[model samples]
Target: MTGDIAFGAGWQKTIRVGRDYISVKLDDPSFAASVYASLAETDNGDYALIWSR
Candidate 1:
């Protein structure tokens, strides 16, 4: 349940939360849905949901 995610390019960044979760932030609001969807694809019950604000 511990890993590192490199967002690669663009204005997005990832913040690691200890060894359990990661917080993704998108500077370009347009990529919110896309990013959320991508992360959601990897959901395996370890997480509740991939959300954006």
Candidate 2:
């Protein structure tokens, strides 16, 4: 799946990691390179956005 950032310039595309976390690739024209991140569930039922190198 693909989605645009709310009130932001960039967009995100879902990536299949075959794990419990939700992986995505983010990109924008101003960015030098695409960023990869994952949303992992926290103990409080919230999600944390973890940036990957």
Candidate 3:
């Protein structure tokens, strides 16, 4: 579970196992639209998504 698209920021409850096993489940249409806004470079030199509020 590298990329985590959770409702809130956490490691326990929102722990992502794997992409094949767990894809981000955002059923909330409004929340979904807000979460997927843009992409940005992470400090780890890898790419990650920038979710909007």
Tens digits of per-residue lDDT for model 2, 1-53: 89866422323444376336666677767777777777777778888988854
Pull out the clashing pairs in model 2: none
Q: Give the winner by lDDT.
A: 2
**Each prediction's TM-score versus the true structure:** 0.25, 0.54, 0.26
Model 1 steric clash total: 0
Superposition error at 2 for model 2 (Å): 19
Best by TM-score: 2
* Model 3 lDDT tens row, 1-53: 58855463322122244221122323355553543333444558776654445
**Candidate order by decreasing lDDT:** 2, 1, 3
* Model 3, residue pairs in steric clash: none
Candidate 2 wrongly placed segments (more than 4 Å): 1-19
lDDT per residue for candidate 1 within 1-53, as digits (tens), equals 98985553333334364234444444444454434322322345654446554
Off by over 4 Å in 1: 1-19, 29-49
